[model samples]
Target chain A: MILARGLRKSFGDFEAVKGIDVDVRRGESFGFLGPNGAGKSSTMRMVAAVSPISGGELHILGMDPADDGPSIRARIGVCPQEDTLDTELTVRDNLYVYGRYFGLPRKEVRARVDELLEFVQLTEKADAMVEDLSGGMKRRLTIARSLINRPDVLLLDEPTTGLDPQARHVVWDRLFRLKQQGVTIVLTTHYMDEAEQLCDRLVVMDKGLIVAEGSPLTLIREHSTREVAELRFGVAPDGDSHEALAEKIADLGHRVEVLPDRLLVYSDDGEEVIARVHERGLEPVAVLVRRSTLEDVFLRLTGRTLVD
Target chain B: MALDQRADDQRAGSTAPTSTIAGAARLFDYWAIAYRRTWKGSAISSFVTPLLYVLAMGVLLGGFIKGDPTRLEGATSYLAFVAPGMVAAQAMTTVFGEVTYPVMGMIKWHKAYFGMTATPLSVPAVVLAHLGFVLFRVGTTCAVFLLVMAPFGVFASVTGVVAAFFVQLLIGLAFATPIYAFSAGLKDESAFSLVFRLGMMPLFLFSGAFFPITNLDPWMAALARATPLWHGVDLTRMLTLDRLDWSMVAVHVAYLAVLALAGWFWAVRRLSRRMIS
Candidate 1:
């Protein structure tokens, strides 16, 4: 449904999105995962057909964005990173007027407004002012407004960035239902767990470049080990001295990453690595054996965590 | 539905309006819907405020000025001379009220323009929709003021009243469109104070709305003549008095029309730069 070859976006002298290629198939959930300044939003803006591409070839539904922006926009739904809900109108009116902007008939828009309010579970707040809504409710209203036209593709930027845990789950449930309904979803997020939960395939971006692309499990397998053992010793509570401890347990696992508070030992067998550590007579303060996740893969690829 | 089924359904639904005017009118529905909720807030300013102006300035103050009709510039009474100018000046204030802070809020605070453009609406369509709302506001406020003043016998003929009504709309657009462009380009509304104080206030007082411009100094009269509001005031005054001069009417109409056209293009260009890029 969307294709980009060497897509570029530059603001004055600073390039937010350097040349990058992307392909998003119809009815698939795709994602861009990165830190705050990793150009994920810039890439989404180009695909939204709102921002002009500096250089590249982009085709959305077999039409060039430059030549057919309005046409392309008509088929796609966009949830911007910031909530741009109309504060001047009631919650139902926000959805009602947005549908009219797409030239929907008044009766059709009215029907869709009620259906979408129900879909997003905001029917009770239909007449409430937008400013009265909580952050998560506002976000849901924005999502509902975006879907008012029954768009073929939905673009959500940082869909659940500021929501609390329960609210995030609610948003995720609605998005999952949309996916089950066969809507193509494109989203960007800094949370690895969000990417793992929602994206069927994803690309990790850093400093305007894509560093890796794969499904969550495949990425974890290729860039990280099957399991990990975290150990913290009382002798060196928090310092660079973890490097010495890492050297002591060097042969215990495939690799050891030294952190200020602890040491992470990557290996296929976390219990075996923990047993070897005990045999060495190192009375560590804590030890944990856990399966590796996409967080580990991102750390291995970018040398930095996803959120910070 | 799957992607292909959805695309086919959209094709069958007549997804977007075929013409630019249709798109803009559809977008205009937003303002109309919003106004339905808040029209009461503006009722005092639209109806009561103009009544008070006529009572205080045209009726009470005219008692003193009624002693001399010679300085009234062909007007039979002070009420007759000042009522049309009040209508014209009211258009100026109404247009500024619609365009300044609200336009800033749309661009910076609420981002309503961004919301509209995210749909099938283009930037030009958004601009047209907003200015169309401004014109509506100007029409309603001026129409109320005209209706209120009709009992006072200020209008010379019904045709003049009708002509003045259209001129009021044109005057509002002439001031509103360019200011709409200016407000869209701003980051904050701090500069709007200067627009009201330095730009609008002077034109309101010196544009022959109260006294004749011929009573002012020659340089001041020339400066007043140069303002868009002055042309509006003069045209409205002539129309209400049934004093028709074909040549001056052409010049005033042409002047306001050129400004409105130029402002329309400027608003479209500036808004596109801000929203599309």
Candidate 2:
């Protein structure tokens, strides 16, 4: 549904999206996972065809935004990173007006408005002002507004950001239904779990470049181990003492990654690695054995958390 | 989810998406919906304020100028002279008021225009729709102002009121388009205050709305005639007072039309840069 080759976006001397290749297929959820300043939103904007590509080629629904922006936009839905809901109008009117903005007939828009209000579970708040709805409700309204035309592809930038876990799940469920109905979903997110739960495939972005790309588990398996053992020493013994601990356990596991507050022992058996740590007489403040995840893959690739 | 599948079944057949007229009307549709809820609040500016301006300036102050040979031109009453100018001025106010804060808010605050563009609507369509809404307001305020002027006997010809209404629309567009461009380029709204205090206030006071521009120093009169509102006031006065100078009327029309066209292009350019970038 969407394709790009070495797409570039720049503002004066600053390049927001460096040259990158991407493709989103039909009826599947594709994700761009990254931290802030990873240029995910810029890439999404280019794919949405709202912002022109500074260089390289892009074909959204087989149309170039430079010439066929309106028509391309007509066929796609976009839930931008921020809620651009019309606070001046009621929730119903927000959907109504947005549908009409697509040149949809008033009667069709009215029917769709009612149905979308129900789809978002906002039928009760249909008459209420958009500002009065909670952030989650507003986000749902934005999603509903994007679906007014049954867009073939939906571009969502940070769809679940700033939402509570429950709210995020509701949005995810709605999006999953859309995907099942054969709508291509392309979303940008900094949440590893959101990427894992929602995306069939994703690209990890950092510093205006794509660092890694695969299914969540594939990314984890390729860049990280099956399980990780996290061990924390009491107050790190001293500021410089964690380095000594790192040396002690460096030969215990296949690999040891040190953070200021904790040490990650990457191994097939995290319990066995902890045993080896105990055999070395290193008493720790805390220890956890957890399966490797997309978060681990991201840290392996970029050495930073998804959100920070 | 079962409910959703049923809901999907209900909307199975889709109407043809494109409409020849609906595209242009899309943004106006938004403004229309918004106005439906807020129209009453605007009666103060549209009807009452214009009425009060005529009462304060044309009737009460006009009470002092009925027989003045210099100001009244020894023809119609002073009320007739100033009524249409107030209508034109009111139209300018609604236009300026909308294109300033609301335009800035659409760009920076509410992001309403951003929402519109996310659909098939382009930035140019958004700009045109906003300007179109301002024109709709100018039409409403002028129409109402003319109606209120009816009982006052300020109109020499009923058709002249119609002519003045169109001129107010022109004047409003002339101001709205460029001010929209200016407002869109702004990083903040500090310049909005300057727009009214420095630009609009001077034009309102010295634009021959109440007195003839010729009453001023020749240079000041020339400068007043250069402003869009002055041209609006001049044309409105000629139409309302039954003194249509065909050549001067043509000049006034051409001047405002040129400015409106120029402003429209500038706004389109400014908005395209902001949105498509």
Candidate 3:
């Protein structure tokens, strides 16, 4: 539904989005995973046809964004990173007026507003002022407003950035239902678990460049081992630091990484690695064996945590 | 099925998304609905404020000035002369008031315009809708002001009052479009106070609204004549007093029209830059 090649965005002297390529298929859940300044929002804006690309080729639904921006925008829904909800109107009017912007007739918009209020689980608050809504409720109202026109593709930028865990789960559930209904979803997020839970395919970006692109499991498999063993020792005995401890158990696993507080041993068999660590007579304070995640893949590629 | 409906709507060619005027009107619908809820807030400005200005500036003050008829600009009464100028000045103030801080709030605080652009509406449509709303406000305010002043023997001709109403709309657009352009380009609202304190207040005081420009020194009179409010004031005064100078009328109309057109284009350019990037 969306395609880009060598896409670039520059604000005067600084380029936010360096050359990159992306292709999002119809009815698929796609994500852009990166740190705060990884050009994910810039790329999303270009695809949404709201930001003009400095140099690139982009086609949304087979139409060039530069020439057919209004037409392309007519067919897609965009939930921007900021809460741009109209503070002057009620929740129902927010949806109603937004539908009118797409040229929906008054009756049609009224009907759609009621249905969307129900879809976002905001029917009870439909008549309430927008400012009175909680953060999660406002976010849901924005999502409802974006879907007023029944857009073919939905673009969500940082969909759940500031929501509580329960609220995030609520939003994720609504989005998953949308995915099941065959609406193409494009989202950008810094949370590894959000990407893993929502995106069928994703790209890891850093410093305005895409470093790796694959499904979540595939990326973890390609960049990280099947399992990891985390071991924490009590304040290291003199000269027995994390680095030294890592060196001692380095041969027990495929690789050993020394952190300030813990030592990570990568291996296909976390149980065997833990056994070997005990065999070495290193009395550790804590040990955990867990499967690798997209967080691990991102760390392996960028050498920096996603949130930081 | 939804795509099919959208295609049919586009082909129909009169809906908001497919037509510029329709789209802008649809966007304007938002403000209209909002106004329904908030119209009471503006009652003071639209009705009470203008009424009070005419009562205080024209009636009470003009009571002393009517004794000196030579300086009353050939009008039969002081209330008659200053009333229409108040209407014109009120239009200017109303339009400026609507476009300045509210325009900034739309762009920076509420992000309402950004939300409109995310849909099928274009930047020009948003600008047009907002300016149209300003025109509506100026029209109603001027109409109410004229009505309230008529009982006091201010208007000489009923048709002239109608013409003055239309001129007030032009005056509103002439100020609104340019102020909108200025407000759209601002990063913060600190400059807006400068606009009011320096730009608008000076024009309101010396723009032939209370007295004739000819009463001023030559340089200041020329400065007053150069402003849109002076043209609006002169045109409105001439119409309400039943003195139709076709030549001067054409000049005033053409000047305000040119200013409105120029500001319209500049506003569109400024808004496009802010929104598209």
Candidate 4:
């Protein structure tokens, strides 16, 4: 549904999105996984046809945005980072009015309004003012409003960023259902769990460039070990002070990374690594065993913290 | 407004419910919806306030001026001369209120324009729609002012009052679209407050609306002649007095139209620059 090559966005002298390439397949969930200043939002804005590209060759649904912005915008749904819901209108009217922007027939807009409100579980709040809704409800309404055009591609910029855990899960469930129904989903999120759950393929961005791109499982397999063992030491809170411990345990596992409070030992067998640690008579304060995740892969790839 | 009827036809299950959009009419629906929610609070600015100016200047002061012959400005009565002045001034005031803070707020505060442009609507379409709604507001305010002016028997003919409506709309756009151009590039409301106090208030008082520009020095009169509101006031006053000057009418209409056209160009350029990034 979307394709870009050598995409670049610059504001005056500062380039927000350095030259990069991306392709989002139809009916699949694609994600841009990066921290705050990783050019994710810039990339998403360019894809949504709201911002013009400073330099790039881009196409959405096979049409260039520079030549066909309005026509291209007609077939895509965009949920910006901030909720742009009309605060004065009713929750349902927000959907109805936005659909009218697409030049949709009023009857079709009304029909879609009903289905969307029910889909987002906003039926009871149909007549209520948008200003009175809670944060989670507002996010859901934004999502529902985007879907009003029956768009071919849905672009979400951190759809679940400020929501609570339960609210985030509800949004994830709704998004998963949309994917099952064959809507191409493209989103940007800093949450590793969000990327792991929703994105079939994603790019890890750092600065203005992409460092890696792959499926979540494939990324973990390629960039991280199968299992990880965490170790803490009696030293300064700064993880660099535990370099002595890193040296002692460096040969026990395939790789070792020292963080502020914990040391990560990467190996195929976490139990065997822990036994080897005990055999070395290095009794750490605490230890934990877990499978390698996108978090580990992201940390390994970018060397930047996920959340600022 | 016929969009409502078409929507009704669509709901009635007409043969095919196609959405046919006219020039900037669809974008006007956004402001119309906003007006439906906030119109009650707007009465102070649109209806009640403009009428008070009519009463204060035309009715209250007309008593003192009726005994004096010089202040009549060749008209039969003071009420006759000042009532249309109030109408033209109200059009400028109403349109200034519509354009300045609201245009800046939609971009910097509420972000409504961004929401509009996120869809198929272009930046120029947004500018035209906003100015279109501002014209609608000018019509509403002038219509109410005309009714108030009628009891004083100020209309020389029914067409004179009808001309007031069209003239007010033209004057409103002439004043609004330029300020809208300035507002599009503003990052803060500091300039918005100044435009009202320093920019619009002086023009409202000195643009030959309250009194004849001939009373001022030649230089101030020339300055007033350059303003869109002065032409508006001059035009409305001539129509209300049943005295039509063909040459001045042509000049005044051309002045307001040119300003409106130039301001529209600036508004489109500045707004698209601000929005399309």
Candidate 5:
């Protein structure tokens, strides 16, 4: 339903979004997973038709955003990073007024307001002022507001960034329901688990570029081993010892990943690798055996430290 | 039977309804929200300023000029002459002030315009909606001021009140349109402050709001006569004192109409260019 080729956005001398290509299919959850300033928000804004693309060929719902912005936007729902609810309005009025902006009739707006309020679980507080709602409630109301037009595609930017664990789960459940209804969802988040849980396909973005793209499990299996054995050596292994340990594990597994405080042995079987280490008499302080996940895939692709 | 009926209702309601008038109606809804949310501050400033000016300049200052035929202007009291000007001045000030700051806030500080633009509402629709609210406010303030002036023996006849209301609307449009244009071009809040200080204050003082422009020097009087506010004040004063001259009234109307048209044209061009580009 959405396609972009050589899409670029620049502010003066600095480029926020370099030339990149993306295509999102209908009825699938797609995500852009990146740290802050990784061009996720910039890319979303271009898709939302709020920001003009500097250079690109873009289409949403088979219409060019440059020429058909209003018509394209009419069929899409967008939940921005910051809540833009009219704070002076009642919760129900927010939905009704937003519906009116799309030229919805008053009767239909009223009906849709009631229906959306029920969907977001805010029917009881429909008449309450928006300022009186909590952060989680406000986010839900924003989501409800976006759906007033019953849009074909929904864009959510960091939908659960500041929510508590319970609130995050509630939002996730609501989003899951939307997906079940066959709505196309596109979102951006720094949370690895969120991407894994929600996105059927995702692209890992770094420095305004796409570094990797695939399903969560496919990415993990491609970029990392099936099993990882974490070993922590006591007294912080010296350079010589670290080299020796890397050499020892190199023969035992397909790959050996060394950190400042720990060593990772990547192999097909964690137990087999551990048994090999025991036979070699390399006493370690601790050992943990776990399956590979998106976190390991991401860390391996884009380092562990946060990027601005 | 009930289940069948509910299913029928759902089928009937599934088709979306649309309206061409929805855009204008939604703008009014937004204005209603702004008015209800900011009623207290809007009321105090619009009503209180004219009343205080009437009290201080008309009643208090009138005591010192007691029995001075030159200051009284025929049979009209000092209160009568000054009250209508206050009404006209307040209407201009109130409308100009309300439209500029709030419109700029929507554009920059709060980003309300961005929010509105994301919807199907057009940019011209937003600008017109804001002007509609400004008109409503200018009308209300003028009506209340006229009521207050009538009890204080400010009006010579009912025509005076009608003329005052008309003048208020004219002056408001004249001031509001250019300010709207200026606001669209504003990069910072300081530009608005500078316009108010250097432009608005001078127009208020020199536009015959307090005293007759004839008392000023010839060049300054000509400058005042060129302004819409001066035409509004002169026409309002003439109607209040029942000194109705058809030629002079025609001139005033023509002057205000031209100024309003010029400002509106500038505003429309600037707003459409800025938003659409």
Candidate 6:
């Protein structure tokens, strides 16, 4: 449903998206997973045809986004990262007015508004002003508004960013249903769990480049170990205690990662590695063992830290 | 079958949703809605301001101006001379004040124009729609002002009142379009207050609205003739006093038409570039 070759978008001296190629198949959910400033929103805007591309060839459903932006946008639904809802009108009027922009008949728009209100579970608040809605309700309404034309391709930029856990799950469930109905979905998210639960295929983005592209499990298995053991040690008991610990586990595990507050042992058998640690006469404060996940893959690719 | 209907709607046409005609219709609809919302406020202000102006200026100030009460240049009273200018001034004020702030709000503050553009509405559609709404407002306000003028003996005949209303609309459009263009280009709201204080106030005071241009200083008279508002007020005064001359009529109509055309042309280009690009 979507294709891009060597996509590049730059703002003056800085490039937000640099020479990345991506493809999204029909009836599949694709994700761009990255930390902040990873060019996800820029890539989404390019695909939505709202921002002009600096250098790239993009085709949405076989139509060029540069030449046929209006037509391509007509068939695609975009839920932007920010809530750009019209606060002047009632919640239902926001939907109706947006539909009017698509040249829908008034009667059809009214009917769609009713159905979409129910779909987003906002039927009771249809007459309420948009400003009166909570964040979750507003996000749901924006999602419903995107579906006003029953678009074939749905683009969601961080669909569940600020919602509570329950609200996030509700959104995930609704999006899962859309995927079942053959709507091609492309979403950008910083949350690894969300990418794992929703995206069948995803790419890890960092600093305007895609570092790894694969399925969630494939990325985890390829970039990370099978299991990880986290050992938290107290302040150094003697000289170079962290280095001493790292030396003890150096041969036991495939790799030893030392953090300021903790040390991680990456290996196939975390239990055996923990036994080896115990045998070394080191008494750590905390020990945790778990199967590796996309979080580990992401951390391994883009270090463990917050970006903005 | 249902999906087919959706596809057909998607492929309907290339024209923007807010086409010129549809935009005009939507703007008219929004104005009607705005009127309903602001009617009580408009009613009190519209009735009170004109009544106060008539009582304060016509009755109180009329006693000071030396003139034949029944025939000041073929009019019954000074009230008759100043009443139509007030109406025209009100219309011009309504159009300029309404169109400028709202257009600036849509572009800079509210981001309403950006929201409108996301749909199939073109920038030109928004401009025409707003202009259409301003015209409607001017028409309605001028009508109410004319009705209020009647008991005060402002209208010499039915044709005079109708011509006065037409002249008010002409003045409103002539001022509104260029102002709308200027307002659209503004990046901040501060400039609007300056426009009203420095620009509009001067035009209102010196536009022959309160007195004859012949009575003013020669420099002020020249300034009044150059202003679009002066031409509008002059034509309205001539019509109300039943002293319509062919040459004066031609000059008044031609001046307003030229101003309207020029403003509209500038607005079309400015709005198209700002809204569409």
- What candidate 4 gets wrong by more than 4 Å, as runs, is A234-240, A278-283, B1-23, B43-45, B66-71
Please provide, for model 5 over B160-221, each residue's C-alpha lDDT reduced to its tens digit, 9 standing for 90 to 100: 67876877888788778878888876777877788788878888888887777777999999
In the range B57-77, model 1's lDDT, one tens digit per residue, is 999999888635578767999
lDDT winner: 1
lDDT of 6 by residue, A1-308 (tens): 89899989998889999989899987789999998899999998888876778897888878887777667766778897877776666788878777766666678778889999998899999989888988889899989988887777889999999899999998998888888877789999998889999999999998898999999989999999999999998886464578777987799888887777788888999988888889988778899998988878877887763233
What is the C-alpha lDDT profile of model 4 across A1-308, one tens digit per residue? 78899999999999999988999987789999999989999999999898999997899988988887877787788999998787878998788878777777688889999999999999999999998998899999999988887777899999999999999999999999998986789999999999999999999988889989999999999999999999877664653367778988999888888787778999999988889998988878888999998888878986656886
The TM-scores of chain A alone, one per candidate, are 0.95, 0.97, 0.96, 0.96, 0.88, 0.93
Off by more than 4 A, model 6: A230-265, A269-293, A304-307, B1-19, B23-36, B67-76, B104-110, B213-225, B242-277
How well does candidate 4 match the true structure, expressed as C-alpha RMSD?
4.8
lDDT of 3 by residue, A210-246 (tens): 9999999999989999999999899954758777788
Residue A297 CA error for candidate 2 (Å)?
A: 0.6
Q: List, residue by residue over B72-94, the lDDT tens digit for candidate 2.
A: 54237788777877887887888
Q: Which 10-residue window in model 3 chain A sums to the lowest lDDT? A: A236-245
Report lDDT (Cα) of residue B78, candidate 4.
78
lDDT string for model 5 (A1-308, tens) is: 89989988887778888987899998899999988888999899889877788887888988888877777777788888888887777898888877777766679889899998999999999989988998899899989988887777899999998999888888898899999987889999988889989999999888788889999889988999999998888874353477677887788877787777788888879988888898888877898899987767767887763333
Clashing pairs in 5: none
Q: How many backbone clashes does candidate 1 have?
A: 0
DockQ class, candidate 6: acceptable
TM-score of chain B of each: 0.96, 0.90, 0.93, 0.88, 0.87, 0.90
Identify the superior model by DockQ, candidate 4 or candidate 6: 4
- The best candidate by TM-score is 1
Worst 10 residues of 4 chain A by lDDT: A232-241
What docking class should model 1 receive? Answer: medium
Per-residue alpha-carbon lDDT of candidate 4 for residues B50-74, written as tens digits (9 for 90 to 100): 5777678777877777534355555
| Tens-digit per-residue lDDT, B1-277, candidate 6 | 7865765565454233424677445444344544565678877777777888888888899768765644455566788888887888888888867877788767766466665655545566667777887887788778887887789877778998887788888888899888988887777788888889888888888888887777788998898899988889888888988788879889988998888888888887876567542
Q: Tell me which residue pairs clash in candidate 4.
A: none
